[model samples]
Target: MEKSGLAEFKVEIVESCLVQPCLPDSPRSTLYLSNLDNQPLVRMAFNTLLVYEACENVLPHPAKTIREALSKVLVYYYPLAGRLRKKEDGKLQVECTGEGVLFVEAMVDNSLSVLGDLDQLKPSFKQLLFRFPFDNALEDVHPMVLQVNHFTCGGFVVAVSFNHCVCDGRGVSHFLKSLGEMVRGHVKPSLEPIWDRELLKPRNILVHDLVSNEEKIECKPHSWTPPVYKESIQMSLILDFETLKYVKDGIMPKCFDICTTFEIVAALIWQARTKVLEIPHTESVSISFAVDVRRSFSPPLPNGYNGNCIVAACAKAIVQDVITQPLSYLVNIIKKTKMSLTNKYIRSIIDTDQFPLDVHSNQANIILTDWRWLGFSDVDFGSGSPVNICPMHWNENGINASNGFIFLHSPERKDNGIKVIMWMPSQEFNLFEIEIESIIRKYVIKGSKF
Candidate 1:
């Protein structure tokens, strides 16, 4: 059993296999990866999505069933099986020789109940259940890797890691749902992926205002695990739809603006996070959030065309400016930033041909990720809906702790509010909760004043 301060569980790898696509595109050719696929962090950031499926009657044997299904799903996703290679012009492309995905079979000699609630898993607890266990060698550079953990009580966990450059969250969903279809004995994936990277290639002459060379946001290295520990001290706050409407209503009259849930959430959390950092009032605070450009394309990225179709937008202002001004003030900044993410903005980002890095604002910087209603609950791998679907928390060491971030989770079926996952030093835990709740409470008690 591997142990951390939080929990203990024994994980043993049963087998490792390279599951290639059942059929590669005829007359193998190198796939041209577009600029959307060439972002620097795309290869650097390994996205880990953990799916906790509860106990089921006569659970399917995972090793045999999953491997068979995954093989079939890869038929359409064969590019993932190939390794990422750099071309002569410094662009990244898929070598499509169909080397295959690294699939691991593992067993957890424990039950899901013992793991407790899926939402509150700490780093140590997470490490135990989902093991990719690669040594960071050149050989370990895979576009995708999956680990299936079978529990003693018949429930299981699935962890999928993918290079952000090759695909985005939505693409992962398409692939997984396809795998599920195969596991359930379907002949084909319900959603067939359309791979036409040529369609997304950038223009000959680039034009973008937000991410030009001189205006770019500077980035710095920080700890993924802030000085704070992601223990039970890490908790969640639920802002129901009703409360959201109330809060939006409150901000409207005071800030004189209509606000979406995302704008409201980002504005609220940005100020609260700034306060937590305890930076000087005059210090500048920044907040950046991801925008999906799937619909921004002229004809739109084909249905199920999930690659890295994102460009980050940010609002930067002095700490006092963000907090003391009406909530509308901060909301406007965020809204303007979003508005700037036009098709030209994305084209300018692609023109950079590097990670369109969000320039880091030194103090109390926050990255808000909205993952609500992504429809992961609909992905059933032979069982019904998963009890929980969580991305690995950003608490790992070396992701700048100073610049705070939030990944907003989808509201559960039984719940009307959003669930958020955040990581920072445990010492600031109380301060953050108080700040967020205080804002929510103020609006709760005193209705929006016209």
Candidate 2:
């Protein structure tokens, strides 16, 4: 095995296949992709890592069981087996030919001890963890791929790669849970996947008469490739309850008794990330975050609707304005931005098929995505619950490593607050860490009744 600058290991590929439904369940008709599903997912694969401790040794015959379960699950999620092809109009749709999903199995020479904490998946470590061995060029056609890596210490990691066009983080969790159910001897999934794109299809006529031109959505059609920050690194930070409560109380309005957790956390991150970068005070910077539109729409999306029902909410400010503002000031901005993500705005964007609009953000143009309720903990494949589940960004498309993007998620084992995993320029990371810690510490001191 040729080794790079990162740790070296001999990876042996045990098996590879295009897994299809054991029983024949072909799509009666071609599936037309929905507007929400037609987003960036089509261009790249969203990868994830689930690590489990080596308590039981079931390596004897987990293969046939796993394959059979995947086949059963595939019967319901058939689009995974279909091909995404562009139509005459240049829009993409799925040709449900039941070609099947790519599945790979490999064995690593090392153990979890050598791997340490997987919370922050560095690029070098990511090389061993990525699901598909091939490059991003194959993602558009191969919508889903899987890899199971067995470590020498008996611990194993399940890596999955699926197209972003098919679904968002919630949908990925749903698909994985289905696989887990099948792996645990259930013939059918707990929640059946719904694939009717017409549910979100735009009406032929303009529906809103009272809406003004100001609220109209903008369409930006341009090919964006993910940015590559070769010099940047990923860092994970845990926000405890005391830190969160202090910050939230500091930001909460006097008249208001409470505020959302996201508002306070987002505000702190926005300010800290921007300050650490030491951007010019006059420069305009924006932050991009995603808001789920499933329940936000007039009629809620189906419970099992697996598609990209998310929109970006962006907020911008001059660098000086952000750095000088009080924590409450920034928190209010984030709250107001979220409040603006109304059903009206969501419908407008859906009807126009426009790009996601910026909502609440940190300058230096950092992007933060919330995945607290994605339910990765429930994804147990015959073994006990996973010790850690880290998401790998869709770096192939427009999600570059140097973009200062981060993910905020609930702790792996039920802690009060959230954790952040982000990638940024390595040079500023030390100061960035200090800035964030002190931000909370300052709030904690201020919130004292004294």
Candidate 3:
């Protein structure tokens, strides 16, 4: 076999395989209890398997070529092929004791569907990789769930659901890109993965030690104890770049030039939510923004580095203060928080070795994580590219609340704008919608002068 450029790789469908499960001993079995702080974090691993009708031109033997590529990619993630375990002392650990890949067949035809709606075919894929069924001890050995479906036109989609604890968004993307490169015949990966956990080991910082008494204070849940609230949430209303720009323009002029789309929009929504919820002015609210820390490493993490490489930067203030403060002030605070992503801070968190295991109840909170910057648009599963991609469901890390928000680029539009999909309580959603409408209307007549 001659070395070829990435274009020489082929595509084919292979039956997904499931590995055999291993029962943990009494001491090792206890690790499962610690993950119960929220829900168990499991990684769903799958690929959109598309068979190319044009494979004759692309390769000599499509099936053989694709199998070779898959083998190569699998070897890279070999270190991660294991199940999570807990020590008797409650420390969580991952043991690489699993083998073989789990797979299933798709019920639908290869033609007549689009690649972007790959998730739609999950129901018929039949063989699930992992399900959290308690006490049965003989748990399935598959670490990731596989969804195989055919597109309406002719192709297949392989989507994997990975536990966030196993890898973060960046890590997953790196794995996928490497797979794609292997398929395309790029034998040597551009960014080799690093597995030395010691590189991220935390130093001794009394205030930041995760297991220390003082560090536990920071992780302790807040005690607001407000009336219980609940609401059904769904993904709706996809906005284009122009609409988002229009909304941003409306709020920018009210603040100094330093304000960002996130802070401005967050402020408006926070104010509207307070009024609609009829929460007292004295009550405090906080916005939790997920910040990527890839660049915070001393020498900077490699592009292929995976795992949770992010931290949350939270901004808290009374509802009245948020509504009354200049947008500039809020923006400045956010900027300062972002600047805190120094190596010291990251080392502190990683060293504390404590995952944020508890949810703060006292703070009225909302989560904002931007997928726009994640290069989702570049994910090409052999059918042009995904028209749009959004997480239909997100569970794990105590972010299953109704107030979470995930923003992605609008796949329908080619412009440099963003689409925000927010999951807020019913009252908060209504208030946010009304304010957004008003802001859009206001910006149409008068643009930002800032």
State TM-scores per candidate.
0.86, 0.86, 0.71
Give each model's whole-structure lDDT: 0.67, 0.69, 0.49
Alpha-carbon runs more than 4 Å astray in model 1: 1-6, 24-27, 52-58, 88-90, 119-139, 206-235, 254-257, 352-363, 393-404, 408-415, 447-450
- lDDT over C-alpha atoms for residue 57 of model 2: 39
**Model 3 CA deviation exceeding 4 Å by range:** 1-16, 19-68, 109-141, 204-231, 243-257, 272-274, 324-329, 354-363, 394-400, 414-416, 424-431, 447-450
Task: Give lDDT tens digits, candidate 3, residues 78-193.
Answer: 54455655456644455565453444434343342222222222222322222343233323434444444444343444455555655666666666566567767686556666
Model 3 scores a TM of: 0.71
Best by lDDT: 2
Residues 1-450 of candidate 2 have per-residue lDDT tens digits of 011123555667788888887777567557787777775423456778787778763434444466677888998998888777777766777777788887777788888665555544444455544344445343245887787878888777788887787778889999999998988878699899888888888767675632321222232322222233555555677777667887766666641335777767777788887787666676666666778878987788889998878777766666677898887776666666666777887666668766544332222466767777788878878776777777776354323455444444544446666777776655666777788887777777854531
List, residue by residue over 365-442, the lDDT tens digit for candidate 1. 686677664556667876776776666644334233434444445446535667666655556757887888877777
Better candidate number, 1 or 2, judged by TM-score: 2
Off by over 4 Å in 2: 1-7, 40-42, 57-64, 119-124, 127-140, 207-230, 254-257, 356-363, 394-400, 408-412, 446-450
